[model samples]
Target: MINKGANDLGGFLRSRRERLTPDAAGIEPGVTRRRVPGLRREELAELAGVSVGYYTRLEQGVSTSASDAVIDALAAALRLDPAEHEHLRILATPRRPTRPRARRSKLRPSVRDLLAAIPGSPAIVIDHRADVLAWNRLGHALLAGHVDFDAPDSRVRPNIARMLFLDPHHRALYRDWHAKAQVTVAALHQAVARHPADPGLEHLVGRLAVDSPEFARMWARRPVRTCSSYLRELAHPVVGRVTLVNETVTLPDDDQQIGLFYARPGTTDADALILLAQSFERRLAPGTPSRKEEAR
Candidate 1:
């Protein structure tokens, strides 16, 4: 088996180097001999304030304990964006001294209650790996009408990012698939940085890269984006067209995140959302009692 632990560091360094050109780094390419487009090893070393031999060792995965300052210099030398800079820190940091605790998989009852109380808004809580831990009825209807809300922990549960890239339903739901795809990839890139040792996350990324050519291509570009707040234009099958402002808030006590979706106060989209909620309620009425009754 490939030592993915070391390969990740080496792969990232090689990719960053190949992405830059000698001219871009203000280094003249010698007419005599040149094998690569980017700055040579010596040039990158000089720019990053390290010896050529030391830089080579780092790239070859021989040296893994680089200081934050050194990694920052390397990032600056590579012309990394915010996302890439963060990734470099993650990759260069030494392995944890102690094994990390297994992430808690269950959502707190209080959090579920909060989601249920948001009657008009659609909201969900996701774990660090972007697994859907829980969602309100409206959230289930808005994001994955075809998925089973009662079985969130099931393997069949929908992943927002995975659906965006692999599922045809998501492709049709978002008006601008390219834009949504970029954000999804960027968010995944950030998540990878935060949890580099997570085997489950690694497997998911590998599967997506292998299965979707589009995902593979975008992953190579190494775009980094954080989606704290954004507007989503959703083409709901029942609601037709609606624009919702999405916000992601971190839970105070855990690594869970809550995503909330809201429409403007007095717009046609808001009306459509109300109609969609009503339709969703009707659909669920036969299977279970009213949401209020369930709470009681």
Candidate 2:
């Protein structure tokens, strides 16, 4: 598995450069037929104002470091977005992570209180490794009422990435599973790059690479993203259907985030959220079997 660091820089650069054609990059195509789809290595090196030998060394992972000016020129040549540019820098010159616990990270009580305060909304807190640290009652009901609400507090906590790829119950929640799966993989790439020393994160990637062919394929593609908000459509078993505006509030100090989902006001979708709250109130009991378990 490709854990994000100096190792994947070459692959990531190759992937990005392969997607840009000669015409798109303002390079003239000569009479010679090209073997590759996009800009040739020498052409890209010329565009970025670097020598062919040096650029070749960089792309082949022989040269692990690059100056800021070189990174800027390469980012410009590749037409990388802000996120991709950040990712390139991280891979090219990785900073030692200040906090590398390599174990289960904890949630602050204040964050849990905030989730509880938003009773009608579906709110959850997840750490950098995508472990579900905590979720309010409505959040639990809206996403995974089939599982115990307190599962996050257990020794074996719920992991969002694992659920998305490995759990059939969680997969059924998404109306457009592939889209979310893509985002999840990209987000994981960002996380892995930022915290390369985190063993839990490494193990998560390793396990998914082994278990899910689809995830393995996506992982190999080297997508990099950092998410702040998302628009998602869910075919919830209880709610039937609802479109949620998911906003992520990052806690940089703790490497955790609070995810809040809201529907537009005065719509049927708004009413459905209330129904989820009520359903949770009706059936959520300590040690009681979840709806999925009862079905079994």
Candidate 3:
């Protein structure tokens, strides 16, 4: 019996196959018209050194137990990048069924301290669901000062994906909101493949799809992307436009959490960050209501 995972794997393979053209794969387009949009199954099988019948079975969800060598060869034939290769591996493998239990999605105290120790850089830690688990003072100010730093523990947690679309404050925070939205949706797509059995992730996706038409459209496009270090421009209300290299580091000890670090050295952008930090310090003064409280 083909399981949901196997079916999803087959669909992903078919979608990827349809994305490549015969000419792009260095194959003759042929004099006759082609019925398939991209490289045919037989052609892909030949490139991957597998029999056409076996490849067909793989694509049809009849064979889900592909060897690592076969998976690697297929990834090469498809010309997949690092992120795509990782997504392909996730689809081909089945996730072990998770027992129904409440899992703590909190950051470690030591990690929180480490985030605070990084003086000049704005940093925050996020869980697998993109919930801001913990952040330093500057990070809180730069990203979502309007939302409480302790919001992650509350019923209304600050999910990056949710904020990107639903929250006007978060949308206005980005200088290039469209580009950031595309990346955010794509990363969520990859996460769905990685954690197929996670109900929380499923719920988040479903909720966004229902609430935001833009998100629904993007989700339908099936963009697959994972996060990486890249230059980001932020339209910070207090400090104005700020540019920084945003790098997300995955912790091996706590795979569920990713640490996002932002830095801009020796430039006005650095000065902007310092000003933002100072503003956050002012917000913390005695008898001063935080930005979060002022909004209430």
TM per candidate comes to 0.86, 0.91, 0.86
List, residue by residue over 119-187, the lDDT tens digit for candidate 1.
899998887766788888888888888877665756555677778778887678887678888987776
lDDT of each: 0.78, 0.84, 0.78
Cα distance off (Å), candidate 1, residue 284: 2.2
Backbone clashes, candidate 3: 0
Cα displacement (angstroms), candidate 2, residue 236, comes to 0.5
For candidate 1, the TM-score is: 0.86
Evaluate model 1: give its lDDT.
Answer: 0.78
Q: Per-residue CA lDDT of candidate 2, range 1-296, in tens?
A: 64454236787788888988999899877998899988899889999999989988888888877988999999999999999999999878846547666597977878877887888789999998889988987888888887877798789998888999999999999998998999889988888777767788888898898899999899887787777889889999987989989999999899888889999989888999988887767775545765633532
Q: Top model by TM-score, which number?
A: 2
Which scores better on TM-score, 1 or 2?
Answer: 2
* Model 1 segments more than 4 A misplaced: 1-7, 29-34, 97-104, 289-296
Report the lDDT of model 1 for residue 89. Answer: 82
Provide C-alpha RMSD values for all models, in order.
Answer: 3.0, 4.0, 4.1
